[model samples]
Target chain A: MNTTTKAEKTEKFAEHLDQANIQGRGVSPLTKLDPNLTVREAYQVQLLTIQKQLEAGQKIVGKKIGLTSVAMQNLLGVDQPDYGHLLNGMVIENGEEISFHKVLQPKVEAEIAFVLKKDLAGPRVTEMDVLQATDYVLPALEIVDSRIADWNIKLQDTIADNASSGLYVLGGKPLSIDKLDLAQVGMVLYKNGEIMNTGVGAAALGHPATCVAWLANKLFEYGITLKAGEVILSGALSAAISGEPGDHFQARFAHLGEVNVRFSNKVDQ
Target chain B: MSTVNYQSTAEFLHRAETEKKDVFRITADYPDMTIDDAYKIQEKLVAIKLGQGHRVIGPKMGLTSQAKMKQMNVEEPIYGYIFDYMVVPEGGALSMQELIHPKVEAEIAFVLGKDIEGPGMTGAQVLAATEYVVPALEIIDSRYENFKFTLPDVIADNASSSRVVIGNRVTDPAGLELDLVGVTLSINGEIKDFGAGAAVVGHPANSIAMLANMLARKGEKLKAGDVILSGAVTGAVMLSVGDTVSAKLDGLGEVSFKVIE
Candidate 1:
């Protein structure tokens, strides 16, 4: 059970997170500190951490969804998924060489990225609203990291850890969602020219836009609205793959072209 | 029995693997082998394989699914190394003369985009590091007689890893409902087994996370371009000569191979 006030816990978690990011060393799971921490309190802790990052001059870019698939949800023993805010510092360009030393522990997944042309605020946001909001969709690579040690996290623990959002890459050509069947779009991923995995749009809670719609509605509870020009990563299209130095990754989308990334073998001193 | 050095134990297993013969379980002789001792044996075996000109391709997780865990009566997953020599081309034939007691299972493979060094790796971190995922078929041939062995025995046997065939198709993992991706395995044009990606530790990537964290405990890390086999999604299907096995993954595509005399 929580021994401290909600505000105190939030502040403590924020400081812990900041330290983890700066030190590039993951801390113990937050759930270990307070077994009774609720999801609501966890989000509050997340917001507090995001506020600190904002104070440090990082601008909000968009949001990401985690645990959207039943497998992830079941692994966490949760019925619903969680969301995290993406800041400007978390954006990586395609083909960029990510230094291994900059992050605590990073893994990558393929996703469909949505760049909105119009703002969306929601209490009752529908998939149609997401489609109508109209922007462009592109192939994306999301680099997810955890501040919690060994990923021994509960739903609240990850929520407080900013939903484990790390960095992302947006590449390939963008296409309007209306022109494509978001649910049937085919995707193939490769590592060093070898086929690794394949997926389609329906993998993301039926459609990528549907996930964005869910994010919009979920954010509305906090009086937050998804702003225009933000890059929204719906969720992972397939199982996450562990990365290694000198590895090159490429994802080919049926309609969006290809997105590629490489990791640097040299660790920053 | 005094604890055997990893070298001798590895040598013993290597002979069995290379000579294509079964050996008595190390546990049968040692009786008091520790898990560390077994892993050390595995490491030594991998080193020997490396010395023999087989490159380390990636790592493979075993006993990740609930069915496997239950079958093994263990609560956790085990891992072993995959070598370039272990890869059987898709639709290729595997000679029965080369293996002892071979079996097959469906799996999902993760190819990394970046290196993952973990003291505390998470599933998200695994996803972020991944470049893509693909459907896979793993051939496990236990060197112990009758395919019976203890945990230490199996670990020392390199988790029974023998061969693997990856599907031709690759998919971006973004927005993929990996757990729901159904797998249908056929042998001789008949459905032999069926499962989903979820069978591998709920989601296949989670198994990779578990592998990374587990390896980190030993001061090892998953390198970039490594092709990791998440784990088996179904129970092993016994293989016989003239058997044609095919596994089709829901969206990822299918991989098939034949067992030849």
Candidate 2:
């Protein structure tokens, strides 16, 4: 019989998400699976899933923040945000074709991926601290996939499912942080060669740096420090764009150049 | 910035475009018409044209030169699309009957080697990905009366885009003094106007980079194999029936087309 203990419940949810990801599919919403789950409990499940990936030999290349944009915050009806770990396997090469079977109902979002030059710990991380610790920023196209079926996820459900992250493609151009007004940078997302979405840096929690500062502070509560050279995806600049097999996506940022990616028509052989 | 409904205005613009006739500027009717409204109309007009089996070849810039911008009393340049049907073959004839009052502008076109997007798109990126720089000519024909319209009106008219004649000479832009490249406009074997490449938004490549950035704001980006009309090097010269129009660039050679009555 399945026990209702906190540890058992967290383990079960973690195993469920891990299996769903391994099978390239999604399951019922975690909140639906266990209506009593709390935000803190959800974070425990997330950490457990990360542990599983780490055990499978995938290194933690970076971290990601979700629901930072007001548009996204409104979409999920949440006033707060979530975080997740990004495994090395989740890094997609720029302009590479992504296998159809590797994702489950994926939606792409444009972002500014920050590469840190110094360790950043929370408790008092400010925007200035984030700027000073950053090496540079790269244009990024992040594929956010939901393990919660139909994307029917509450904040807790997504938090437990690793913030719905799947894969990310980073652009080649590395723009210096000091050269930009993060709040004024604009972005456009193309799907299958057609324009589909547009946004500005201010869309991501008023500024991309603000999100980075928030991430550092949030992680401090859990005793984690963002290490030097680690990539931090600062959340979506625009709304998530859903696409299908054979569709090509390009996210171009003003002065940031462009990043290209394609979803292949065939599943992995 | 007014997101006021523009479906009906778009339909009217579509009808005017199909008939190849002049209509009052959209701002003539709605004096408060904004650039956003013009872009909405352009978007709707493109949709209508696409539905009619006409394909968009690529994007083109307008008023890219500071001189033209000042002459037109505008602060910034505008852009429009080049429909596949607008591409006039080399040595082909541009029909006067098919278009309204058409004027030809000498231009340098960039053929992109890779897809480029914007926000932070730079001139360096534009130059790096440019596969070829070819001399070209644009035959701009506005649906607005006497070819006179406000900025918003011209944008709604697809930046007064009509036809284009691309030259055969494809030269690598590297090592060439692009800003110093001299271009001359000849009408019926006589020089009409002349300017250097710098006249095109300080540099012809800058125009393309600007176009990429401008389009990026609307969720669009230039892709590989797309030919971009950078902008005019000199003033747009009025065309006449049976007239031979040619533009020669220093290193890129010449592109010429005949106008038929």
Candidate 3:
């Protein structure tokens, strides 16, 4: 083991996992193969792989955060959140409909959106910095779909599955971040004029700013940087909803504006 | 002093959606099921129901409080979804036998004002996109043949979400301490559950953010105006037919419903 190269070790480990149908548990159950990488470090390996994939061909658009919700952190037995990579080709814009057939298991959620005015560098970012750096805010929708069969997955599995993310729809009007009273903003989720649920921005870690701050800090440790022109979806205003074709979903923000999405029976690019 | 009975589940939900009534009740045959197994089957049933035209609006977080999570034999809270057809009016009663496994919880649901999608987002970003907030009551009904599941099984089942009831929107966020907002859930005039907004992953909004970022990586992002049930602020309590459950939040309003045969 001491004589083996890193690439050799990875290859052997990958083979062993396939042969045994096992994961992790080599040095620790937190990661597989590399004994030196912590669970966090192992995640970095995957991230680097994604980076390389991007370097090779895929376009890097943004990143995703997870476990920010205290419920999920507790459920996964962690205190903070986790994250994964995103590609430019992945996001679906406003008015774009989603097909039920393309997703394995799909769910929907509503969230706040931020378009950065400047680069969000790590190791020194603050909530105020977020405010200063942010250019516009908008209401957004998320479609969560997992490729894993039966949605049977563990934390690592989900991490590998890109946090079970799928498609996204941006709605409503985009407002300057300065013009909005983000903390006090109200939201109403409706399907066909009927209110399904309602909530406020304070529910998101007191403010969506906190969620952004956490992400900036989280990435600093991973050697990742939050660049300008990146779109960030800060958690759900609440739990996600499930929808099928022909259903119209909308989120109405008190001052910022509102966004609406329609689901189609067939997946439309 | 007046009791109203709905003939069908669809009718009950319609009335609840219209805000014409605020009270709803349901009766279930099983009084002592764990809700895990019941939830797994509920997922399949929900898919079928959604396919049949009953839209799944969103999910509710159940057993999100630290105390409630401890009681549930896990460190984290559970989740469940709400459908357009499952809305039950407050103060009204629903049939218990119609459900596989049913439980009641107090939750705060956030209605989105904008469409959101992300690969990397934070709490502040969320607040900026928000419009208003509302108090809600979520009914978790497991569709599993029996309430039995491992931790992951429950997660996949969307935490046994059954239905949701959202009160009017509150326009002020600065006036409320979403994390520590105290709530008291009573059944038939007896307190059955009690907790605060803080119990939901420190704050309900933080939970919503977590879901959003997770979606981003998967090529999916949260849309604006989407209603998100952050998670339950308190624990879930056992409900029987003819039982009335109500939750009172300090600043946010109160939400209540009844269970009947």
Predictions in order: lDDT: 0.84, 0.84, 0.62
Runs with alpha carbons beyond 4 Å of true place in candidate 3: A1-38, A52-56, A191-196, A243-248, A267-269, B1-261
TM-score of each: 0.54, 0.54, 0.48
Per residue, candidate 2 scores C-alpha lDDT tens digits across B102-124 of 89998899999999899788888
Collision pairs in model 2:
A253-B118, A253-B119, A253-B120, A254-B118, A254-B119, A254-B120, A255-B119, A255-B120, A255-B121, A256-B120
The model with the greater lDDT, 1 or 3, is 1
- Give the per-residue lDDT digits (tens) of candidate 3, residues B51-71: 678776764555555544555
Where does model 1 sit among the CAPRI classes? incorrect
User: Candidate 2 regions off by >4 Å?
Assistant: A1-4, B1-261
**TM-score for chain A in each prediction:** 0.95, 0.96, 0.78
Which regions of candidate 1 are displaced past 4 Å? Answer: A1-4, B1-261
How do the residues A1-269 of candidate 1 rate in per-residue lDDT, one tens digit apiece?
36566577789877876777777788888788889888998999999888988998999988999887656877999877789999998877888988887666777788889989999998899989988886898999988888987777899989998898888899988788755666646566667875556555656675678899999999989999998998889987766776777788887776677788888888775
lDDT of 1 by residue, B1-261 (tens): 686788999999999999989988889888999889999999999999989899989999999876567777898899998999889999999999988889999888999999998768888888888898988999999989888899999999999999999888888888676765656667997655555566677678889999998999889999999999999876689999999999877667789999998
| lDDT tens digits by residue: candidate 3, A1-269 | 35456455444433432221232121222233233544553464456546555766888676666555555655767766666666765677777766655454566777788888788977778899988888788888777765445455456645644566667777767688765556546565667655555555644665678888888987898777888988887766655677767778877665556677777766543
Residue A42 CA error for candidate 1 (Å)?
0.9
Could you give the C-alpha RMSD of every candidate to the true structure, in order shown?
14.5, 17.6, 17.5
